[model samples]
Target: MKVRAATEADLPAILAIYNHAVVHSTCTADYQPQTLAQRRQWFDVRVQAKLPVLVAVGEGGVVAGWASLNPFKERAGYRFTVENSVYIHPERRGQGIGKLLLEPLIAEARALGMHVIIAGIDSENAASIRLHERFGFRNVGHLPQVIYKFDRWLDVVYLQLSM
Candidate 1:
């Protein structure tokens, strides 16, 4: 697998992976599938903000997973922090693609002078929690029933790694 900054050509694959998680999993709280236009806007915002958006490509040049660092908040006080996101193709999980996508993203965050990288994960996602822990992210807090999706209440777990 190879990991690098995302290109425009990678957006469709990223969108597919992301929307799949949104529609079928608790990994993301967004219940509606995001459109290509929305994903394009997302990419534009990250570019405008000078944030990192990375992708992992497997054999045949398919995007196996992706990761990004987005502004934690618009307020000045939050400028030093970024929220991290990672998504892998459903069939590509358990092959360390998530980790491959994330490690470079974290490094990019540090290189960009970000002080903290935060991850908001579904409390039930043990794999994600463990992934964050392995990367030295500390569990900061938990918000109970912060989201209602797929006819169920979902808890959110916050993890942070100080860079």
Candidate 2:
């Protein structure tokens, strides 16, 4: 596998991975599967803001996973902090692809003068929690019932790794 910066060409696979999570899991709170145009607009915004979007490509040139450093908030005071997202192909979990995709994003964020990297994970997602923990992220806060999905109230845990 090889890791590299993402481009427009990766959006289809990225969208597929993201929509899969949205439709099947609480990894993301999005209730509807996002359209390609929406994903493209998202990518464009990230570009406009000069953020990093990375992808992990595996055999046969498939995008197995992706990670991004997004602004935590629109307020200027929050500019130094970034929120992170990582999604791996369901069939490709437990193979360190997420680690490969996330570690570099953290480094990139720090290089860009970010003070912290935050991961808001579904409270019940042990794999995501463990993944962030392995990279020195600590559980900083929890918001109960912040989201309602799959006909259930879902809790969210905020983990932070200071740069």
Candidate 3:
């Protein structure tokens, strides 16, 4: 497997992975699968912000997973903090792809002079919580029943890693 920066060609695969999560999991709050144009706009925003978007490519150059850093807030005071996201293809779960994608994101954050990295994860996702914990992220806040998805209320846990 190879971990590197994403290119224009990788957006479709990334969109598929994200849409799968939107339809099948509560990891993201988006209720519907986004259109390709929406995904393109998202990519453009990230690029304009000079943020890193990385992909893990496996055999045949397939995108196994992707990760990115997003601005934690819009205010200038929040510029030093970023929120991180990682998505692994369902078929590629439990293969350490999440770890591989996240580790580099941390380094990228540090390189960007970020003061903190945050992860707002589904509270029920123990694996994701554990993955963040393994990377020294601490559970900073928990908002119960804050999201309605899949016909039920879902909780969100905020994890943070300060540099």
> Estimated TM-score per prediction?
0.98, 0.98, 0.99
Off by over 4 Å in 2: none
lDDT by residue (tens digit), candidate 2, 1-163: 9999999999999999999999999889999999999999999989999899999998899999999989899998999999999999999999999999888998899889999999999999999999999999999999999999989999999999998
In candidate 1, what are the lDDT values of residues 25-119, reduced to their tens digit?
98988879999999999999999999989999988999999999998999999999999999889999988887887788888998899999999
The per-model lDDT (C-alpha) reads 0.92, 0.94, 0.95
Per residue, candidate 3 scores C-alpha lDDT tens digits across 58-140 of 99999999999998899999999999999999999999999999999999999999999999999999989999999999999
Q: Give the lDDT of residue 16 in candidate 1.
A: 97
Error of 2 at 143 (Å): 0.6
Clashes of each: 0, 0, 0
Q: Clashing residue pairs in candidate 3, if any?
A: none
Order the candidates by TM-score, highest first. Answer: 3, 2, 1
Query: Clashes in model 2: which pairs?
Result: none
CA error at residue 126 for candidate 1, angstroms = 0.6
Ranking by lDDT: 3, 2, 1
The predicted structure with the larger TM-score, 1 or 3, is 3
Deviating ranges (above 4 Å) for candidate 3 = none
Alpha-carbon lDDT of model 1: 0.92
Per-candidate alpha-carbon RMSD to the true structure: 0.7, 0.7, 0.6
Off by over 4 Å in 1: none
